[model samples]
Target chain A: MTHKRVLSLTLNGKNRQDLVPDNMLLVEYLREVTGNTGTKQGCDGGECGACTVLIDGEPHLSCITLAATVEGRKIETIESLAVNGRMSALQRAFHEKLGTQCGYCTPGMIMASEALLRTEKKPSKDTIRTALGGNICRCTGYVKIIEAVETAAEEVAS
Target chain B: MTEVLPEFRVVRPATAQEAAAAHRDNEGARYLAGGTDLIPNVRRGIGDPDLLIDLGGIADLKKIEVGANGARIGAGVTLAHLAKNAQIAAAYPAVITAAKSIAGPGHRAAGTVGGNVCLDTRCVFYNQSQWWRESNNFCLKYKGDTCHVAPKSTYCHAAYSGDLAPVLLVMGAQVEVTGPEGSRTIALPDLYGEDGQNYLALKRGEFVTAVLLPKDVLPTVYEKMRVRGAIDFPLAGVAVALRRDGDKIGDLKVAVTGTNSRPFIVEGIEELVGGPLSDEVLDKIGDLVQKQVSPMRTTLVAPFGRRRIAAALARRQASALFAG
Candidate 1:
C-alpha cells in the first residue's frame, strides 16, 4: 500500500502544498506534480548529478531524496534562478561563455553553481571545480563551464 | 528515464529507541538515513522493504560532541558537515579527508557518516539495474543461486567499498548501537562479518547510533584508488595511522577496504613497531596488504590489479604518515 501525505514546502520562493506519495522522489514531485521540468534525471538513480537541487541553500541529489522528508524546507531548482523572468548572473554567464553544449546537464550544473555563488561571492577556480564536481557534462569538457562560473563570480562580486 | 521507486510507507521516528521499535513493529522495515546508497539499491530491486523508518527527524543523531574523551559523531550528521566542521578538521584530519573524498559535492551534502560506514557491498554484477541483473540471471548476493563472480563457489564475492570504515578502523573507534533489545557498544572491527551477503554483524532491528573516537588521536592518512577522482567508489582504499618515535614507527595501525567483504586491519602490523621508516619496512607493509586482501571479479578492474594497487596504496600512505 502506498502512503500519501500533504507535503508543505517552499518551492522556488513560493509555498506549495501537494499530496505526494511517501516514496516519491523530490525530482519526480518537482517535474510531475509541480510541472517543473527544470530538474533533469540523468542517471538511472544517483550516479549522475543531473537531478541536483538546492535544499535549504545546499546542493543535494533530489533524485535520491524523498519529497516527504523535505517538508517545510526551502527547495530551489533551476526554475527559481531568474529574477522577474530575466536570467540570473550565473545563467547569463553560462549563455555568454557557451557553458552548455547539449544542455542536458546545464540545469543541474547551473543550480549547483548557484549554490556556490550564493555563499562565495568570489571563489577560486579550484573551488568552482570542487563545487560542481558532482555535476557531469559530457559536452564542453567542463572548460567553458568553469569559465562561466568564474565570470559569474566576478560579475556578482563587482 | 528516471527509475521509479518501489511503494513503501515512510515512518519518521524521533529517537533511536523509537526507530528500533518502529522497525520491530513492521516486518521488513529498513532504517533510512541519507538514502544515497539505499535508494539506488531499492530502485534496482535489491531488497524490497515494505516500510522505511526515516531517521532524519531524530535530532540527537545529528550531533557532533568533542570533549575530554574525544569526539562522538552522531550517525545522522551529514558528510558535508564533517568535511567543513572546524573541530573535526582540526582534531581529525583523516576523518575530514575521507568525508571530503566521498562521492561528490551533492553526495557529500546529503550522505552521512553512518550511511557510508554501513554501505552495502558492491559488485559489477550485483549493483546493476534489475533488467540487467535479470539478463545476467542474477548473482549470489541477491536472488540468484550461483555466485557469478566466483561461479563455482557458494559465497558472494561482492567487496565492501566504504571509505570511512577503513579510516575509523585504523583510528580505533567504537560504535554505539541501539536495537529492539537494548543498547551496547562494540569496537569498530566487530561491527562487520566476513560473509559478503551478510557483512554487517548488527542484529536484527539494530542500527548504529554513534561512533566514539579515542581521546588520543593519532596522525593518519587515507589513500583511495579509483577510476575517477570524483563520484567513484574506491577500487582499493587504504588508511594508515602511525606515531613516530624519532626515526622509527610506533603504535602503527593499517586498515584496508574495497578489496574484501569486510574492511579489516592488516595483521602483523605490530612486527613493524620500532622499525625504521625505511624502504624495507614499507615493502613489508605492502606485502602484508597483498596477502590479506581477497579481491574478486567484483569490479571492472581485475582482482590481482586491485590487490597490487591496494598494497601500493598501503605502502605509500604508511610512508607518508611516517615521514610526517
Candidate 2:
C-alpha cells in the first residue's frame, strides 16, 4: 500500500536520482539506497545524533528527516567532508587531536563541526559546545573534540 | 520502536487548502509537517494513517513574516530557522529561547515551531514499544482502560512537554487553523484541550497553519528545569511576560508547562500587575502556583519536587523580567 517516488537531490555536490519508498528515512536512503554508510545510526531516536547530516549547509538528524521531504535539497554526509581523496581540515584535526577513541562518533562529530565552521569563522568553546550538543561521543571526552574544532577553525580561516 | 513505517500513500500538496483537502478526502490521513515527532510516533504504531499528506512543498507555510504589529510564524518554520532569525530574536526573544530549549541542534534543524506547539503530550507509560507497553495492558492513552499514573483516575495524565506552548500562551499569541471548512483564528489557549487522551482540540481534518504573536512589546523570560543542560524535556517550565509601568508591573502573564496534561496560564495575574513586583510578591505568586499545580507521577521526578520547581521557575522568571 506504500508509494514509491523518484527522489532527485544534490548529494555531496553531485546530482542524483533514485526511486525511494515514501516511508524511507533520509538516513536509510543514504545508507541503503545510495550505499553511503559513513552516517552511522546509533539511536534511531532523535537522541545521540549519530546520523547527523548537512541538509542545505545546516546540521539535521537524518534518522527523523524524511527522504521524500528533502527531495530537491542538498545533502552533505560524512563522506563529502573529504576533498579529492584528502581528509578535510575538520577530519584531520579530529585525527591529530585524538578526537575519536572508538571512531563510531567521529562521522557525526565531523559533520556537525563542519557545519559550525562553515557558518561561523571563529566559534567560541561554548558555541562549539552548543553546536555539537546534538551529536554524542561516548568514546572520547569532548576536550579533544573541542580542540579539533578550534584547530580546524584556524586552518579554515588561514 | 519499529524502524519502517507501515505502507501509506504519499500526497505532495503545494498549498494549505490542497493539504486540507487531502486530509478531508483520505480516511486516515495525517499532515506531515516537520515529521520529527510524527515519524517516531508512527514508528511506535501510534497512528496508522493510510495517506501521508506531505506539507513540505507548501511555500506559503514556510515563511516568517515580521510586520509593524508583530510576527507571524508559519507552522512549517523549523525551530533552527526561528532560533537563528535576527528579527525574531530581537522581537520575540521568548520564542527564540523556547525554540532553543528543545531537543538539540540537529533535532531543532528539523523540528518545526508549529510541531512543538502541537507536540504530543507525553507519558512514560504511553510512549514505549508495543512489547514494553504490552508488558502491562496498554495505559489509558491508547488501547487500554486503566490510567497507569493514577490507576483509579478516569483520564490520562500525560504531561504537555512542549517548550513553545507556554511561551506562546504567555505572549498572547493567536493561531490560524485551516480545515476543509475554512480558516479561523483563535487565541493560543483555545487550541489546546484538557484531556491527555486527545490533547489538541482540533476539528476533524483540521491543522494549524500559522501562529500570530501580539503587537504590544513586553519583557518576557522563559525558565526551564531539566535533568540535563540540553536534550532533555523540562521537568518544570515557566514563561513570564511583564508589561511594565515605570518599574511597577502594569500587566503580568505566567504560563506553566511539564506539570499538567495541558499547559495553562496562571489566573489572577491582574492582582500583581499594578505595582512593583518585588521578591516578596514573586514568592507569594510562587507559593500560590505551588499550591495550585500538583504534578502527577507521569514523568516521575517527585510530584512535590516538580511543583516546587514550577513555583521557583515562575518566581525566577518574574524577578528577571522585573530586573530587566
Candidate 3:
C-alpha cells in the first residue's frame, strides 16, 4: 500500500505543507510538488550531486533522500539563496568568475557553497574543495568553481 | 539515465526492536538507514520491496556514548558526525580518516555508519541500469545465473568497497544487532560472510543497533587507491594499527577492503610481533596481502592491478605507522 502524508517543512525560508507520497524523493518533492526545479537530478540517483540541498543547514543529496524523511526540517535549495531579487555573494562570484559553463551543476554547486559558507566564514581553498567535493562540475574543470567559492568567501569576510 | 523509484510504503519505527518487528510483520520489507546506497540500487530495479522500515526515527540508533569501555556508536549515526566528532577523532584518528575518505561530502552527510558497514557488494556486471543489465543478461549477484567475473565459479565476485569496515576491524569493533529473536553483540568480522552475493551474515529481520569500540588505542593509519581524490569508492583500501615497543613492534593488526567480498584482518601478522620494523618485514607484509587478496574483474581496473594496489597500500600504511 502506497502511503501519502502531508509533509510540513520550511522551503526557501517559507513554511510549506504538501501532500506527498511516502516514497517520493526530496528532489521530486521540490521539482514536481512545490514547483521548485532548481535542484537538478543528476547521475541517475546519488552518484552525482546535482540534486544537492541544505536540510537544516547541512548539504545533502536530495535525490537519495525521501521527502517524508525531512518532514519538519528547513530545506534550502538554489531558489533560497537569492534575496530581494538580487544574487547572493556565491551566485555573484559564480557569475563574475565564469564558474558555470553548461550550468547544469550551478544550482547544486551554489547550494553546497552556501551550506559551507554558513558554518565556515572564510574557508581555505582546500577546505572549500573538500566541502564541495560531492558537488561535481564537469565544466570549468573546477578551477573556476574553486575560484568562485574563494571570491565569495573573501566578499563575505570583507 | 533516470529511473523512477518503485512505489513503497514507509514504516517509521521508534526503536530497533520495533523496527525489526515492523520488518517481521511486513513481508517484502527492507531496513532503510540513510538511503544513500539503497535508494540508488532500488532505482536500478535491485529489489522489489513493498515497504521500507525507516530506522531514522529511532532515537536510540543515533546516539554516541563515550565511556571507560570506549565508544558505543549508534548505527544510525551519520558519517559526517563520525568524521567531525573530536572525541572519535582523538581516540580513533583512523576512523575519522576512513570516514572522511568515503564518497563525497554530501553523501557522508547523509550516509550512516550502519549503512556503510552494511553496504552491498559492487561489480561492473551489476550496479547498472535495468536496460544495461538486460543487455548483458545481468550477473550472478543480482538477476542472472552466471557470475560474469568468474563464469565457471558458482559464487559471486562482487567487491566490498566500504572504507569504515577495515579501519574498524583493526580497532577491534563489535556490533550490537537486534532482530525478531532479540538483541545480541558480535565481533565486527563475524557480521560478514565469504560469499559476495550473501556477504552479510544478518538474519531475515536483523539490523545493527550500534558499534562498540574497545578502550585501547593504537596508532593507526588508513589509505586507499581511487580513481579520484574524492567521491570515488576505494579501489583497494588498507588500514594498519601498530603499537611500537622501543625499536620492536609491540602489536600490529592489518585490515583490507575493496579487494575481497568482505573487509578482513590480514592474519599471520603475529609472527612479526617481536621483530624490528625493517624493509624485509615490510616486503613480507606486502607479500602476505598479495597472497590473500583475491581481486577479480569486478571493477574497471585490472584484477592484477587491484591486487598489487591492495598490497602496496597495505605495505605503505604499515610502514608509515611503523615509522610513527
Q: Which candidate leads in DockQ?
A: 3
What are the chain B TM-scores of all models? 0.98, 0.96, 0.98
lDDT of 3 by residue, B1-324 (tens): 578889999878888888988999988999999998899889889986899999989999889888888999999999998888888988888999999999998898889999999999998888888899989988898889999899999999899999999999999999999999999999999999878999999999999899999998688899999998888888899999999999999999899999999999998887988999899999888988999899899888998999999888878877787788
Order of candidates by lDDT, top first?
1, 3, 2
Q: Count the backbone clashes (under 3 Å) in each candidate.
A: 0, 0, 0
Point out the worst 10-residue segment of candidate 1 chain A by lDDT: A41-50
Separate DockQ for every predicted complex = 0.77, 0.75, 0.80
Pairs of residues clashing in candidate 1: none
Better candidate number, 2 or 3, judged by DockQ: 3
- lDDT pick, better of 1 and 2: 1
Task: Rank candidates by DockQ, best first.
Answer: 3, 1, 2
TM-score of each prediction: 0.98, 0.97, 0.98
Put down candidate 2 lDDT per residue, B175-271, tens digits, no spaces: 9999999999999899887778888888998889899997875788888998877788889899988877897888888889898888899877768
Assess the local accuracy of residue B179 in candidate 3 as a C-alpha lDDT between 0 and 100. Answer: 96
Q: Which CAPRI tier for candidate 3?
A: high
Tens-digit lDDT string for candidate 1 (B282-306): 8899999999999999999999999
**For each candidate, what is the lDDT?**
0.91, 0.87, 0.90
Task: Estimate the TM-score for candidate 3.
Answer: 0.98
